[model samples]
Target chain A: MRFWQLASFGGFLLLLPLILGLNDYYIFLTTLILLYTVIVMAWYFIGGLAGQLDLGAGAYHGLGAVVTGYLMIYYNVSGWIGLVLGGLAAMGVAFIVGFPSFRFGLKEVWYALASLGLVLILQKIFLLWTDVAGPLERYIPFREFDPLYMRARAKWFYYYITLGLLLITFYLAHRAKRGKLGLYLVSIRDEEEAAEMLGIDTRRYKLVALLTYSFITAVTGGIYASMVGFYHPILFDGWIGIQTATIAIVGGLGHFWGPPLTSVILLSIAEYLRINLGGTIPGLHQVIFGAILITAILFKPAGIGPYLESLIEKVRKR
Target chain B: MDLLIDFAISLARNVVLGIMMGSVYALAAMGLALLFGVANLINFAHGEYVMLAMYMAYFFSVTLVIDPVVSSIINIPLFFLIGLVTYFLFFKRVINAPPLSQIAVTVGVVVLLRNIALVIWQAEPKAPPFTIFSASYEMGPITIPLDKLFATIISITSLILLYLFLERSKFGTAMRAAADDVDAVSMMGIDTGRLFLLTLGISMMLVGLSGSLIMMYQAVTPTSGLLFGLLSWAIVALAGLGSIRGIYLAAVIFGLADALASGMWDPRGREIILYGLFILILWLKPRGLWGRR
Candidate 1:
């Protein structure tokens, strides 16, 4: 029964853009939502498994977008190469920021603030850095559909790409969770002092989680830049970091499939609200987002993931 | 020689401006100091509340046609209540919950408050055209704006009063004791729940005052939450906990960094310098300037 549920969902995702046939705009929006879903899922590594409240997703994501977009635009790099390079660049930044942060034993709120500051610091630097990026947005060279260059004007292509990335993120998170690394991360999250005393190199494990999460988040940034055909300093949005952490926390802190599920539902609703009410009521969608978050945090502190999972278990037994 | 002298004078001027600017920031951080240091809560929405207070200040000044500073009459009491309300609605639950839940709740409040500002006021920057304190005083080679000067004096005074209250008063002593050991304080027959509420309320009152004082000169947009929130947190991180003087000195350092970065380099680069120095400080001195506990 579980296999069938998983298989059908996969099949549905594969056919989603086709089912919505000519509505390229909706496809584009779905892709954008999935793209963020990738980031939120990747957040499972740091926030969920490792128990760090990292608000620096925006930093890594923006860095990936800038690096990939910059290379593609100026150096004529393939999108695949740009994605890899972008991911690597984000990992580099993760090391630079995370190594010191973990080494200094920064945890809880201090760690969160440090990561939050990372997004703003990077944004400001890129804003003032003129050669690669400046105050103005850098537009990628547009192509109707150059498969060779991996530049496309169609939104469905990007949607499928984001879906692929989401799968990869899911698989990576699954592997990490099931593996030895995940154990250390969980123990550290639960009791850092105890984890350290148990001979776990907590800092190294935490840094590993940071690097993995950052790399995935950056690839999404690369994909985002390509889909939009431009990358700007504003890509380093601290709000994205906050929102990603919010969704992950609300989904269920350490549960797999929770954040991705939550992102799809919440983001689609957010996009819907953005479309319908956004013109007349600018931030109504965000207000709704906030209300949902508070409600979930206050009422379902363990998140809906665990609750839904138990329901699934009961139904399966039946 | 002339170039050297010009540099020196400008540096001196920035130092003075930074100190005054620091005082107002001290008030803001003091609020967080109480909630963070005493109440043992981490509020990601600390900046959002300041942003809300700024909007309130703008609202009162424009609608009531009063000076921005006068908005504190409304801002302080109202925010105190708002803080108490937030305590009940959000902070109360997470006080003992895991840090992740606590952070999530507060970040939710950030999104709610920031977007509410966006919904009601839109994203445009808002400020009164001029206030009564807009005038400047020329002190020979250095010039001081009354708006900032008033902000400094009032901020320092409020902080000092908070400091004395914590030091001299009986209830304040309970609050301090509650900070060190909540269970012990409660066992001694003090109501810690009330102390937490009072800490949150008083801290918010400081946020209200800081917002009103800052509105005398600064224009606020929805994004200012990220700015002031990070700025206030940076001040706290630099100062550590348990000392008003440390917070003041740290805020001044940030102010100087802001002044010099904007004054000497580029205004856009100020955040870089400020946050860069902030991260550097965290790495080097996690205990901060006055971190005793």
Candidate 2:
């Protein structure tokens, strides 16, 4: 990474707690933003790089949450171990769906629809799998603050952990974007036939992209379940999928730094809207938020990424 | 044999309802099919246009105390103008843009329209004022609604008119030519831009008509478009991309399938059955029932 990028990220981390100390509400908002940032970065692997719009992030997220919940409840596993197992299970499911989709030449809308179906299917499964999943929210045992169980009584710990995860996900995305795999994926996105003609193993590369995406998203899910201390079918709702796509698109999709930036700005705006408009008007906040999205899309379809890049270019020229 | 008779009666009632429901599906899918077939845009926000039509219907009913049936006539032209404006403002610029960008734009529209509805109307479900014809009529162990019958008739008549317009008229021919190959049609001295706007206007008007008709039987809400949108997508996909008659046939089949599943199983399982069929159909025949290879 560039010197400015590293310095900015480091400064943000160092200053996050200091800012959080100012208000409890800001801490909660910061943690939520970090969690969504993790999910958006995960989406970038397949959506931004491979150009496959997988609308089924909720499926992997839900699966990871269910796995963590089950491990914690039945087997009494530590949250740390549960997180790893949750990620593995999510990856296993991704491979099953991704392999068939890639091999069969499903691209664009077909892939988007198929991935959407995965979330619906998983939601049903979680609903019916009453024994392990439980009908209501499954809670992890509350204990004193422990790094081993990954359970914390305060928001400060979650803030740091989520920040750490965000950094790792950023690094991974940056590496992929700079690597040969990134080149192949971009080629597939731009023109599949030409890429194949140029001897790119499109299917293999896509599968790799999908696996990486699922693993990162699943990890986010694990952290989410622990932080919230509950898991339910509602966690995998279709709206979540829509929100994932919205965050990525709004942030300037296909850019290395876009998703996180978008997540922070949009989530904060949504929270602000909810706080102000939600009490008096039940759904007005959503209305204004939706309007913002529509205006952004109508006017700034390339997202804030290209605009920011141009601004940087102008500065360099000066 | 009474059991058999009951089953037969139930099936007949459902079949009629399915056909009635299919008419609305046909209208909703027409605009999306036109856009996808001609311009190759999936248009994730296509349902929002339908929602907009419903709100328009509600507005006319509430303000002018006009019957929804009468308001639908007004909506046709009004929504057509809105569609035209939308095309000029947003879609026209991105006609040949990348698919991801197209999806993003439409999704943004969907979010904006849905949120607009929430702001203006709140989330409370609203229904357009209905006349006596909106109620159900009992015919000796079977129930049928007059509004649904009217909706079906109007739907079929409009579709037939659309078919004639597309197949026989010069402008329709120009639109078809543009859809087949925009560059080639432009080379042949046709204005492809005008054709796109025309297609968009007509398609959105059809969706507006369906929205008015749908309010006769079901209540309208902000999120109501989500199910209808998905159903229309399923119908269009099943019918093949560009075939009007195919959309009609596919909608009928899907409506019947949906009715049958609801009758045979719990209502909650209806989505599962429909989506399962969608996956199976795509797996077995990716081009759709009538889609060209």
Q: How does each model score on lDDT?
A: 0.90, 0.80
Off by over 4 Å in 1: A316-318
* TM per candidate, chain B: 0.97, 0.95
Weakest lDDT window of 10 consecutive positions for candidate 2 chain B = B262-271
Taking all chains together, the TM-score of candidate 1 against the true structure is: 0.98
DockQ of each: 0.87, 0.43
TM-score of each: 0.98, 0.91
lDDT by residue (A1-318, candidate 1, tens digit) is: 999998998999999988999488989888888899999999999999999999999999999999989998999998889989999999998999999998988878888889989999999999989999999999889999986676898888888888889888889889999999999999999999999999999999999999999999999999999988999999999888988988988888898988889888999989888998899989988899789889988999888799799999999999
Question: What does each candidate score in C-alpha RMSD?
Answer: 1.3, 2.9
